[model samples]
Target: MSKTRNPNLDVIRCLAVLLVIVIHFFLNTKFYDVTINSWQLEIMVGMRTICMICVPLFMCLTGYLMHEKELSWEFYHKLWPTLSVYLQSSALIYLARIGIFRERLSLADGVLGIFSYSTAPYAWYVEMYIGLYLLIPFLNMIWQGCQTRGQHQLLVATFVILCILPTFLNIFGKMIPDYWVTLYPLAYYFSGAYIHTYETEVTQIPLRLVTLMIVLLSVMHNLNASAGRIFQWLPMNDFGSSEIYALTIVIFVGILKARLPKTIGDIAKYIAPYTFAMYLVSYIGDQLIYPIFMNWFKTESAMLAWMAVPILLIFIGSLLLAIAQKLFWQLLRVCLDKFWQKYQVL
Candidate 1:
């Protein structure tokens, strides 16, 4: 039998998807171009910093949930659903570009766009995830080999040093060689495995403390952005820095520790499965909604004031598209199965 779903993990998945939408807000708005002169802009910067944890949260959740997966044909076959959704979403986005945006392209270019993720640029995560999914079984083998908690801790620490520290240290005169920093996904994966291994101990961490750490990290990220603006040598933002790593851990733990109501938990569980689809189709919603809002509001700051509505509209629109896509695929599979069974009988 399949393992029961953990509502807490579901909630984390939901939160991760929402944060993904929130981060895209910056891209859709003039937040990047506007000068950070007012408190409104500063708040937006702080929110952007917090939302940067979106991708890490998803990566860590993968490690936490899939830590025990073994190498097998059955395990590898699970990737088909994700790949199917990605292809369908890409096709939908391409169609939208052609029909809604009136963008013209040859049939070959459209096919190539889906494969290359040019149709839905946000499907880049899907591309990254395909490689990571292939490696998970081997990754779990390494995890299962660890004889003790200390070994697991050492493994996580080593990853941090290799994947996270370089991006952080390189900020100041390239103090650390960052050639291995792209391996940060492995760092998050192992970290999630460690958390899963020690859930009892991790849950004991105070929720208040986790909140405090998140707040501090946001402040530091905001300051970092400000400093980068003041000094040309520094980066304007730290989207995938050690700060995001730390914040993702704290937020993940905090959500796990909190006592969510039954109704809220159930809602999260229902929404969680749809989140991957939502992320893929969100580009459609963004393209549809942002332009209208941008035209309505004169400044990025003005749009920020009424941001909640546009965000909600985009979320709802994307969720509807994802649900429709899911239904379409389900029906297709049913039809294919019926035809195969009839042919076999004949």
Candidate 2:
């Protein structure tokens, strides 16, 4: 049997996901809803600024749980379920878009759609994550030899290189870096896995100092982006980033560490399995649900409704996706077992 993994990590992951959902729901609703309200617009921008840290935090978590044991074709077997989830959701979404959006489709589009990285728009992170997972054996092999202290040092050094290198290349804009040149987001996973395997504890440091550093870095990062400058001083600009951004992720991890666990076996089991599913479903909601909600509420910007509406939708959407994924997995497992049972008897 596999060893029991970190319990707190799950809760932290759940929170990070929620933050992403919360930020997206609010940001999209504010920006795209039928009519824009001033207050809601400002709040959306503000929340967008705060929520920007979600992905970075996610990267940090991925690093924290470094199960760098071995690499095999078998390691990829876990992705099959996730792969199934992606396929099913894509089919459902494509059908819905065709039916509701009145968007035209062709056989070529369907072919391209299948190779989609994640859900539809968020596919980049999804496909890339599986890619990184596949490489874990090699990365772990390199990491395992280093002492704990060495691993931590490597992470810091890697962070600096990943963060700055992109900026230098990007100095010339689209012509220089292009698509393939970007790898910072991928670096986050490496950073996270490195920490989990090597970095001993976040608790040893004082919380205030940690908080200050996170805030400072995140601010500088965002300011650079808003200024239309050449270099984005933060982590992972393509997926959305700011300089102080990674710092915020670290700070949030510290906060997560301080909080008590809010979930047990069942609740944990319920939310944990669906995290990716929810990630996929949220995109659907972003494209479809928010549009309808925007049309319905007709809320003015700068109003509390702007903030409240998206948060509610995100929570509901994520919760529903989590539940649906669990049931789907449960049914699939049962059916598979039955098939084997029949085969054995035959």
Candidate 3:
């Protein structure tokens, strides 16, 4: 049986989607074009570091929520909803590209773009998710097969060494072979599983300490960015560093342990289901919103001053679009069912 929805997990989902929008802000604005000499720019880099966990949060949430999954036809069938949403969202985005953006494309190319995820660029997450979804049952098998907490710890530790550690070590000078670091999702997945398996032990750490850890990490990220600017050899930021893994874990735990008000929890639960659709459809909002902001604000720094409004607009617009697509899909399903019933009677 499926587990009951956890409000805290839902809140994490909402936060993850919002951070998705936050990370994309760098791409939509002139964040990279300007020099990072100023403190404001350095702080922006820190925010980017924190937001980098957006994808990892989703992956870890998958492990936390679906740790009991096993290989079965019914289990595999769960993918249909995700696939359906993606295909429909892709079609809508394709139409927007042609109609709104006035991008020229032949019929075959349009269809190809939809299937290939080229039409909605952000749907690359969909491509990654499909592979991860297929592997979840097997991953759970490994999680379940562990006979003891120590064994579970060993398994998670091994994944960290192989997948997470290399990303951090290689940043300096390829200290370790990183052939398996691309498999970092498994490391995060197993970490989430470990947390869920030992919630009592994991949550025992004080929330204040958790917040402190995140703050210190954020500062480290800022310092790292500054050093990169000074040295020219170090990177300005590493996308999936060990720092992100540490932050993702502590944040997930802190939120899980907090006593959020019911109203806030309700809002989170409502928004959770739409996050996947929101993430996929946000590219539409970005395309529509960013140009207007660019026209209004002469400088990138000036635009940063009014960042919250555009982010809010994009979030709201994407949420509405996702809801509309979901309603349209449901209506079509109902119509097709009725037509089939009528044909069967005849």
Candidate 4:
């Protein structure tokens, strides 16, 4: 709402965004988690834990900026822009896929998978984002209708409870036909929507400090137990221990908002903006760029390529997608103007 960005929020977004990239980054190199080699293990564990916050934080940002007391036609009016981006991204993805897969892929797979992101190349997040955009007005109803903090917390708790149940019964993982995104991501979406709609800044006082301690404990929990898969109790997945993840995120944001514009804060914001583009082009990096180069390291030639290649690939790929998105947004704006002219109100 202000002309200036909140360096604090931006920093959080940036770090959360890059954690998503770090997932693939670790996958591409010598990040296997054998005990004697634990530096990469730390990276792998940290990344896995951090990524739990990414989408939730994004939706919280969405709810923070866009929520309103009443569902408006204006929400419906934004549809063309969101749809246009989604469609353009899908098209770009298809082209990228064709380039990558070339002759080995079939026309039918292309036709179906173009819109289906789990099947498509790294496009699942974008698809879920578009899906969330379509649901905003309904979520707006929930956010706006909750008249008290208690009510808001109740609703969010209900959402988390439903999302977590299947895991206990093996329902979320197996009995539930579509486990990963559909039921599970709702906890993130619901908690984010509720918090943004209800709370201001981060929690204050002893609660805030206690939350930070809890976050550290949770991170260490994962770090110490990732090899055993016991720490998989953390809700990075649909059936993740969402209570811990949500609490951890809440705590981190408090510290984040307070100390920004420093090195960590700036990078946290700067790196996140390109996460969408990075996802779009990550396979390109992983398969084509990083693997061929970064994986060649044997410690004799230096581990330099491991870091350099992933960063370079992410930067170049994100730059091109950013340009495309800018142009696409401009086109969407023109479309909006035309629609406004026809409707007399926008």
Local accuracy by lDDT, each model: 0.83, 0.60, 0.82, 0.58
lDDT of 1 by residue, 215-243 (tens): 67656656655743531112223445677
C-alpha RMSD values across all candidates: 2.4, 5.0, 2.4, 6.4
* Residue ranges of candidate 1 with Cα displaced over 4 Å: 227-239, 335-346
Q: 1-346, model 2: which lDDT tens digit per residue?
A: 9977655667666666777787666556545333322444444444555566666676666655644658777777766877777776676556656776766876568558768642266666677677766776776776666666766567555654655345444555632333433555545656666555434564555677766665555444444444432223233333423343455556555654565555553465557656766776677677766776767766553345655666667767767855766677679889999999999999
Candidates 2 and 4: which is better by lDDT?
A: 2
Residue 186 lDDT in candidate 1 = 92
Model 2 lDDT vs. the true structure?
0.60
Residue 48 of model 4 has an lDDT of 55
Top-down TM-score ranking: 3, 1, 2, 4
TM-score of each prediction: 0.92, 0.75, 0.93, 0.70
Q: What TM-score does structure 2 among the candidates reach? A: 0.75
The TM-score, computed over Cα atoms with residue i paired to residue i, of candidate 3 is: 0.93
Q: Order the numbered candidates by lDDT, best leading.
A: 1, 3, 2, 4
lDDT of 4 by residue, 189-290 (tens): 666565555455334434666665656665675676565432244333322454344553564446444755478666655555555554565565556666
